[model samples]
Target: MKLQYWGTAAAEGLPAIFCRCETCQKARERGGKNIRTRPNAMIDGVLKIDFNADTYQQSMKYGVDLTDLKYLLVTHTHSDHFYPNDINMRRQGFANYCGNKTMLTVYGSDKVMASILPMAEAKSMAGLLQGVLVQPMEKVQIDKYTVYPVRGVHAAAAGPLVYAITDGEKTLLYCHDSGPLPDEVFAYWKENGLRFDYVSMDCTSGCSPMDYDAHMNLERNIAMRDRLLAEGLADGKTVFCCNHFSHNGAHSLYDEFVEIAAKEGFITSYDGMEVEI
Candidate 1:
């Protein structure tokens, strides 16, 4: 499986919209990996995770055509992660798709489905969108992939979800938009005999200290990784990646943050990073 990170920044993005922080300034000055958009990922060009406001820009920058996208998994209804309005763009008036399958199936929690269903049922977008309300821990089969939705500890209203995907050969744990997961989550992994090949975690706070449980810092990231390793959910061969950064985070610049993360054995994701598992 080839996993591509389309965007790796938090809600505000790197070089935030209207800020003069040192981190944002440096990101603007050094505009390569530092210039991150909102967080999102695509697997093998068919399955996508998180459709945020930056989707359009990320698509153009990465030279990806999303008209044929088959599946979309939304983590939450946060505007930065789930931009429902953009789903309309795939309708008849906006896009001219040549594929036989015109409908794109989206999976998310009840709240996410609620936010998207009404708009998708509108006359303009009726036949182009399909919203499936998936409960936490529900594993669903989508063509060649098995997607397991895990509940996240963020946004009560949003009911955020983390996804574990496997093509029956390699497994990827795409965990984000939440802090450290509950013990039962890990227990479930052990029960299923699940071992991940690639693990992408939340690093919204970067190297800073956070008092909340909605997001993770670098320290929390390592702790979580260590726990996963000790529990046999991840091993030395697993590729651990830290993503979803914020400009306000300590050592927020890509180069600076990566140096810190690398020392502790983690890959700091950039806007257009790709990994093969």
Candidate 2:
């Protein structure tokens, strides 16, 4: 399995759209890892996580052929995570795409389905759809992949979801757009002793010590990692990577995070970061 980090920024992205913060300023001056797009990822060119507004730019930047995607797993209905209008591009007559009668399975929580349903209604392409299909949460098997939808703790209105995806040999925990693990999720992990080969967690707050309602700071992330290790949820074989960083987190460069997380046994994810498992 191959995991590619398409975008690694929080809501506004590094060098944020409007602000002139020091971090954004530095990111503008120095590109590379400092540059970030909205949050999204691709797994083995089959499963995609989150459809942020920056999807187009991410595809162009990484040379991703979106037509080949088999599944789109949405975390929530946040503007930065799920952009409904952009998805319409995959419909007929919008963009020149390939794939024979390609059926794109989109999975998410109830709110995500609600958000996507209206768009399909307005466009009236929901009937003649050749490339997309929206599937609500359940343990669904699509294109040789088994995905488990877990409740996510985030916006009450959005009703978020996190995923545990398994493509036979390896399992990945696509945990973002969420806060601390809920008791049920913890119990599931505890009872099953299910270990993830790859973990892409939420580190939107970066190095802040402040507590956030739906995001994790660097300190919280480290503590969470320690807890995971102590509970046998993670081991040396598990590759832990952090993403969804905000410009407000203070650190401007991705290398800085790599250096910091290295001391604590985490791989800091940046745009275009890829790992083969």
Candidate 3:
């Protein structure tokens, strides 16, 4: 399976729209991978993990053919991850392109469905927006691939979600906009005994204050990697990666953060980074 990183910034994005911090300033000055848009990824050009506010630009920048994508697996309803209005573009008479025969199917938790329904209803129900409310640990099939939505504790009121996908060959666990791995996730790992080929975790806090319940710092990120390894959920062959960075992280530039991550045998994901598992 092929995984492409479209964007790699947290909610605020790198060189955040309204910030003047030194890191943001430096990111602006550097203006390459340092200038991130928002977090989103596409797997094998068919399934997208998250559709953020920056989806348009991210897709354009990456030369992604959005219309052909088969699935959109949303992680959560966080503004940075889910933008209902953008998705409404798929509705007939809304966008320029003719619709695909197989409408892009979306999978997410109840909270995600709630956030999307209103806009979809407004767009006219023409099968343009199809969806399935994914349950925790329940495997759903999209073509030949299986998708699992693991409940995340990012938001207390609304249960946040993350994803794991496999094509019966390789599995990738996308853990973002989330803090520590929930117990249910560990239980699923134990019950399934599946070893993930790639694990991309949230490093929203960078190296700053640690908040394991809401986001992860560099230290906590490494700790999670260790625990996943110890639990046999992943092995050394796993491509451990970190992403979803906040401007507040200790590293002011992409290279600065990447240097440290590389030293620890971790890949610091940047916009346009591609991995084949």
Candidate 4:
């Protein structure tokens, strides 16, 4: 599986729009990997993880053909990750490209459906957009992959989710915007004998202290990695990536973050980064 990270920042992004903090200032000074947009990723150019606000910019920057995208898996209704308004652009008058014939199926929780269904139903999006409500732990088949979503620790009311996907040969665990998951989630993975080839985790808090349960910090990610290895959920060959950064994080500048993450055996994800496993 080829997984590409289109954007690797949290909601505010690196070098946040209005902030002038040290981290943001350094991020502005150090472009390249330090420059990040909201969180979003794609697998093999067909399945997208989120419809971030920066989708347009990411598409242009990476030369991605957004119209050709077939499947979308949303984590939650957070505007940074799930921008339902843009999905409307695929409608008749807005887009008349040949790629429009490819139906885009979005899978997410009921809250995700609630957010997009209203707008999608407002018009005749008939063949353009389709929303599927994905329940926790229920396997959903998407083309060549079997996707299993587990409820996340964030946004209880929104029914947030993290996904585990496998295409028979390789498996991926995409976890973000949440703190350490519940024990049951891990047990489910063990019970099903699902081992991951690639693991993408949230590092929103970066080098800062992880005082809350909403998002994870670097320490939490490291601990999670150890646990995954210890529990046989991931082997030494599994690629672990730290993603979803924030300007508020300390020592989160790309170079510094990469140096630290490399020592901890993690790939610090950058915008437009692609990895094959």
Comparison by lDDT, 1 against 3, better one: 1
TM-score of each: 0.96, 0.89, 0.94, 0.96
Whole-model lDDT values for every prediction: 0.88, 0.76, 0.82, 0.88
Tens-digit per-residue lDDT, 1-277, candidate 3: 9999998899888988899999998988888889887889988888888898899988888887676667888888887888878887776666555544446778888888886666556546455667778887788898878877677758855557777788989999898778887677888877876789999999887768774488887787799899989999898899888899989889836878999888887889898999998
**Ordering by TM-score:** 4, 1, 3, 2
Q: Could you tell me which residue pairs clash in candidate 3? A: none
What total of clashing residue pairs does each candidate reach?
Answer: 0, 0, 0, 0
In model 2, residue pairs whose N, Cα or C atoms come closer than 3 Å (at least 3 residues apart or on different chains), thus clashing, are none
Q: Report the error of model 4 at residue 226, Å.
A: 1.1
TM-score of 1: 0.96
Task: For residues 1-277, write the lDDT of model 4, one tens digit per residue.
Answer: 9999999998888988789999898888878899989999889988899997899889888888888788999999887898888988888788886554777889999999987677567555767788899999898999999998899889787668999999899999999778998789999999888999999999998999977899898899999999999999999899999999988888788889999999999989999999997
Ranking by lDDT: 4, 1, 3, 2
TM-score of 2: 0.89
In model 1, state the lDDT of residue 49: 91
For residue 88, what is the lDDT in candidate 4?
84
- Scanning candidate 4 in windows of ten residues, the lowest lDDT window is 115-124
Q: What is model 1's C-alpha RMSD?
A: 1.4
Q: What would the TM-score be for candidate 3 when compared with the true structure?
A: 0.94
- Model 2 weakest lDDT span, ten residues long: 127-136
